[model samples]
Target: MSALPMLHRAVLAACLLSSIVAGCARKADLVITGGMVWTGLSSGRAQPGAVAIGRGRILAVGDSAAVAPYVGSRTRVLTAGGGLVMPGFVDGHTHFIDGGFQLASIDLRTAATPQEFIRRIAEYAQHLKPGQWITGGDWDHTLWKGAPLPRKDWIDSATPSNPVFVTRLDGHEALANSAAFRAANVSKDTPTPPGGEILRDPRTGEPQGIVKDQALGLVERAIPPPPPAERDSALARALAHAAALGVTATAHMNASWADFASYRRMERAGRMTLRVVLYLPLEQWRDIADTIRRQGQGDDWVRIGGCKGFMDGSAGSRTAYFFQPYADSAGYYGLLQHPEASMRAWIGAADSADLQVTVHAIGDRSNAMLLSIYDSVARAHGARDRRFRIEHAQHLRPEDMPAFGERGVIPSMQPYHAIDDGRWVEQRIGPERIRTTYAFRRLLDTGAKLAFGSDWTVAPLDPLLGVYAAVTRRTLDGKHPDGWVPEQKVTVAEALRAYTWG
Candidate 1:
């Protein structure tokens, strides 16, 4: 044969082989292209990238050209349009159902004055039938001068027909109107509950209708629980809101068994769009363990193998069990929700059951105590991937800072609280101790795992706002342009890592 004919034959054979390979390539169910794709891995990002999905799992992720083979006539295509294509956010802690209700209830978070707070509640109450309990205001009294906690008298007249028991923005305290107090039978003679307080008038000795910590339950118990329909609606609303904000999963703190049932119902009904990890109250650990034993820890969409407990209250409410008295409240050390002995026992039991335990520790004393408890529990259990966490590890003593990493504890913190509380935290704890408040950088530097959250319903649910707070530490009051406790401000990269991967 001639040399030219032989070369032409070789070229044709190569073309046929390429065609055969292309014909055998499987098509993807969906193809997402044209964006900056962050793989959430060490390989870094892929610019102008594409992702192919099939059978509800990612099949390929790389530059657009690399994924082109997966696209077929039946494949659904989505263009990112130069936007970011990253892993969906995972909110480490939330009161998911409560946040859903808050989204639908009157928003008093923006009420800047006493009159505005009353007006908003009154207007919201007007829509309800007489005797309907109004809840979920999430009011922020700090916006007002002096930041005086609201009293019953402030909204008594406005809420004459309805009982009003609205929570403070931190969810650690609540203000009840006269109607609410009357319904709860709260009186000046009523004894304060352990680990709680009922703020009273100084001279008159009358109950001011401001309840802190566990005392909020006094008024809360008097209010009727929302109907099943309302509960379902709240969960649905929250899920939609989370999806819109790019939150793919949330570890719901203080979840009830009812919440778990609702989540499972949603999953079965094909209404669930986001993943949920439920941490029931520590008191229910046995029930949770039994349930887990029977059903097993759930799939990727729903998990139920964690217990949440409170060591103390929050800083804003001044019940955050502290080693020393609060600067504003002379001789008054905050209250501990659980006795040291009881807390240790519960934690040990949970650890033995192989359940993850995360406790809320907002004060230096509480954080230190919980850390000690965790260390003791770890020693007893031997080495394991316990991953015990401290929720709202907000205030810490300088000496206790190293214990987090040393003890293999995760600091599940909310960054927005730093900026939100910065507006008035100094008034509660004073200047020197405020240095370690919301110590994100310090915690990270100590080698503690960082799991960021929004504490939605107490603060905004938007993770972007959380990132801003983490990176800037700018007070919501607009007083600190350079950043509040600027020393604690983390780099944007660090903040993003906490939100996404940590």
Candidate 2:
């Protein structure tokens, strides 16, 4: 053997040290390679690259070759194979528990005609015991070719064996049979509750089977609450169904404290697969302060997020409080779900408790009222980074658009609503206000953070369908080839961001 020179030995030591240093650096547990990765980064950039995940957090993101070294021999690899690899999408708002119940309940979504609706209910009633309430038919008469609103007489004769109460798709209206009316003891003499109306026949002045807004509560109060076991099964089935649809995260809107406990129990047992963010009903905030103070903001998976308050009912039901009168009923503006004073009080409480507030404002007046309340909160809170949200900011005045961005309010909107409601929206608000209805472009232009969702049970939970609707503004009936309000059309990328981690 030849003796090594000092210079050569020093060079060899340097090479070994470099190897050791590189080996000691952090390594990734899993590295996804060979795909187009849209990071949903602020810059909105996409590159052919790889992502490195260790334990749970992302370790690195760079070129495939550079990231490959971090992948250990034990690591499992996923080859994207030219597919898009993006962050899991987040449905900013939904009613998961209610949606779960809807999945299990009597579905009336497809009864195109009033006769067809009666036939379906009669079919469902055959399986039930006599006098047992046949609940949960989310029907819409507007979808029928002639678009005629049905009366009690239509379903009364068919479902006479069983009492039936079917909600309108928007939950703003309900069609009840005479059997249901008799059970609830509702009569023509009964007075409508504040902020609610029972549609009556013009000729005879009798209850016309349609109950609008808070009037639904009259019939709803007659139905018994679901037992705990039934709720559990519903949630389990919902989680499984949501997982199948590629929904990794969801936010349950307008849930009460009792509902939150169910979610917490499910999460603790590791039975929940999708991430859930619960929003307590605004009125129930005082009851959950201690629980929320301990839990605060949630992790990436399950959390108690905020409170949801209703400012107005939906447009389809003619309960969405408008500045001007509805076309069908002159001098008859829609009702407000919450008074301005009541909204201010609830919002102030939510702010004080450090809870992010999400208000449902579907009409221009409702939207404006919410904006004013949010503006007040901003001034009182003094520029804190709390991300307040406006659930279903569906209708707006052009002047009020900028307030959303100025106040940093995230418009947690449902795009499917526009497509679903657009077919008949003109009849409700007339042509002029309809221009500002479902104003996605105007909201975006004002720099409002538009967070998209399906509202699930109200519409389909499939986010892809929502993306198509938002980008195309296509009515469900396929009426407009050019698109409903084509000017409000958003890009595929913008719709994708609203559904993605955004």
Candidate 3:
């Protein structure tokens, strides 16, 4: 063959290669079919359907009969067997890393009483190295017959050698031992920070070793950060656990850009199974703004989703900022973490950047302040398609009921928090305010988008558990047979939407 003929043959081969590559790129690798698919589309349109996936993108979704033709010889097929195939659940508020950390720690979630709680800690303490931080035992003592708070005295002997700090399931309060207090350099004389509290012995005028709300920082600062490898291992376990529960995505509530970087690395490595949307703290607004200016905005699956601000703490801790006094504790209202002005500024910047904003507001006053801030920011931003969220919209004022929908704010709530908090909320907010607290039905009726979440590490990550609680309104102890605040109950469909579609 002549040199010119050989060159012509090479050119023809190159053209064929390009054509084959384009054809392969356009072909779908898999098709899912034969399911009662609920598309979650508006106007209640649904049918026996199929979805074709190509390169991880949905190629098409429609009648299975029509989509079956797209299945090529090489395509993998999945039949749903007439099962309900809905969009994967999305948790709008979670602490992914904290959830992972909890998974790796000693679980004391079933500790029925203070004694059992101390025993569990004592067992965990025996295995730890000297001077190591004993962390993440979310022990709830409210289930005790008298619903008493655990004092340091009982756990002192159990964990005498090891420094111990066990948080309440809600994370609003914690019990620390003498060793932990000494390790953290905290004492009875140390004044509590603003918006926090230190429980004290009335007669002795000494610290009782119970720290509430913002006071948890007194002990947390003493613990060190986990290594990168340890974090990755825990995160892997957390994602697998999430997948088993039918979760496809989640919105992390208090993640930093550093955490976002870790997520990105996981995504690139194909190790991340669930879609993640991270919310940065409001304190890092300027830093995030400068970074966003350089890198531009992110996408739906994994993005710098929003700014998270705290308005108050949990009602269980009597630290949820409210308008009125607690019946038991005279003149006591929960602490307010941020002022309206500060919250407003955070919202304004987040809105302008088109970033979603989610605020943690568990008390009536906190919820009211959040609503006011959302209203102002929405007005200033003009007509926009932003999804503003209010995390843990736990308590509500009657007058502020309509504001949630009117301002187009989403109530990103955790239903388990209601079941957990309902038992003691009345003591903190009085009976009148309790009527409107955890009003899921009322929020939906007033036109708010109620996005359900587990707030894992705070509650179990099982959406079914949450759905059961929302529909039943049953307290943790099941004290109220008919359900606690039954009027606040939501239907199965509404509860489903909060977790699955909202």
Candidate 4:
């Protein structure tokens, strides 16, 4: 099944409804039958049906009788056995290249203890050449007994010879072993990058190994990038993994120029299996816009024209800027990834150049500020069709919630984070603030353009997992059986639209 772009996938049955009634002359390349076919229509209805696909496009979609005209002797028939035949999922957010590399790098997302986390890295390093950097361990410290952040000393003995910068699943923070600090020339004296923080031991003022938000770049610069061959291998694994999970395309949250080159190489070779829409960094808006104009927007296979910026860190990292202080820690808000003034200027210019702007805003304050800036910029510029998006609109103030739809801002969200985060979100913020967290049903009801994704490399890339979380809202810890923030749970069809459409 080809997972093409969503706008093209819109109205799955429109083609058949309009033209297939008279039937076509050519036989279908493939026919899917014996299933509840979801038309992915605005009506949000499904029925027993069949579909015919040919030449990389949806040929005819409807009941078996409606599709029989296109199926012939050579046409392939796929019986769903009463399963679902819906449009392929288009993940709204992801870190594609990182996800690809993480496929073979390490498995730390499930490391239940600090000891297990260090042990996994040590075990993986045993096979690597000495001094080689270890990257891409999406570990979640929250799963540990006390939910303590991992420190350098805990892993230094295990990884004495290797440099390590294992990221938390949220992508907002990382744990760097001692070797990595030396490699990056970081010291107790090194000033934290603007909009970033270095967690340090109080008395000695020594680094404790946790680097949040922008500070992650400090160690990242020292890590040698994967060679072209290794990148190709990673891409191969990523495409296969995505296809296996029924993901047809992605709106890559934070991609790079190097990553774009790799995608182009694959596209030119006709091996690009997954459709990717890359949102390069927002800081380099000039280069991003210039490149798009010089090369022309790519085809359905790969595309460019968007830039992603970050407003604040993630909630799990305690760096997602909020209206109030964290319940557990007083007088501390989240870290901002970019200054508000800089963000405003960059977004305005990018929009003027016709570049789509989607930014990361996980905290309530950041989300509110982002909405204001986007609204101001759109008004000042006298917009044509600027589809501003708030990536990870994770938290919201009730008053600011309806502005998303009123201003036509797209809430590009990840549903899986709700259930996973719900496991301990109340510990970070009080119960009152939890109501609007991942407000899926509320946003949809108010007419916001809610687009859902997995935030791959941070969360599972599986759309079904996201769907289950959205529909069920059951926390992973088994608490809140009725659903975590149950009022936010949406219907199956709404989740499908966010996955398949915008």
Best by the lDDT measure: 4
Cα RMSD to native, each candidate? 9.3, 9.3, 9.2, 2.2
Show the colliding residue pairs in model 4: none
Tens digit of per-residue lDDT, candidate 3, span 86-118: 667777678887888888898988888767877
lDDT of 4 by residue, 354-395 (tens): 888989998999999999999999999895777888998989
With a 3 Å backbone cut-off (N, CA, C), the pairs that clash in candidate 3 are none
List the candidates ranked by TM-score, beginning with the highest: 4, 1, 2, 3
Which 10-residue span in candidate 3 carries the lowest summed lDDT?
1-10
Which window of 10 residues has the lowest lDDT sum in candidate 2?
1-10
Leading candidate by TM-score = 4
Indicate whether candidate 2 or candidate 4 has the larger TM-score: 4
TM-score of 2: 0.90
Per residue, candidate 1 scores C-alpha lDDT tens digits across 1-502 of 0011111234323322435324536688998898887654544444567777665555566666656787889999999998888666778889999999888888898999988987888788778998988888888887888887888888888789898888888888998888988899988888889878898988877788889987887887788877777888999999999999998778899998888888888888889888788999997889989999999989767788489999999888888988889999999889898789989999999999999999999999999999999998999889998888999989999888888788878899999999989988898899998899999999899988788999987888899999999999999889999999999988776777677666
Which model, 3 or 4, shows the larger lDDT? 4
Q: List ranges where model 1 is wrong by over 4 Å.
A: 1-27, 43-48, 65-73, 202-205
Each model's TM-score, in the order given? 0.91, 0.90, 0.89, 0.95
Candidate 3 regions exceeding 4 Å error are: 1-27, 42-46, 203-205, 297-301, 352-354, 480-482
Report lDDT (CA) for all predictions.
0.83, 0.78, 0.77, 0.87
In model 1, pairs of residues that clash are none
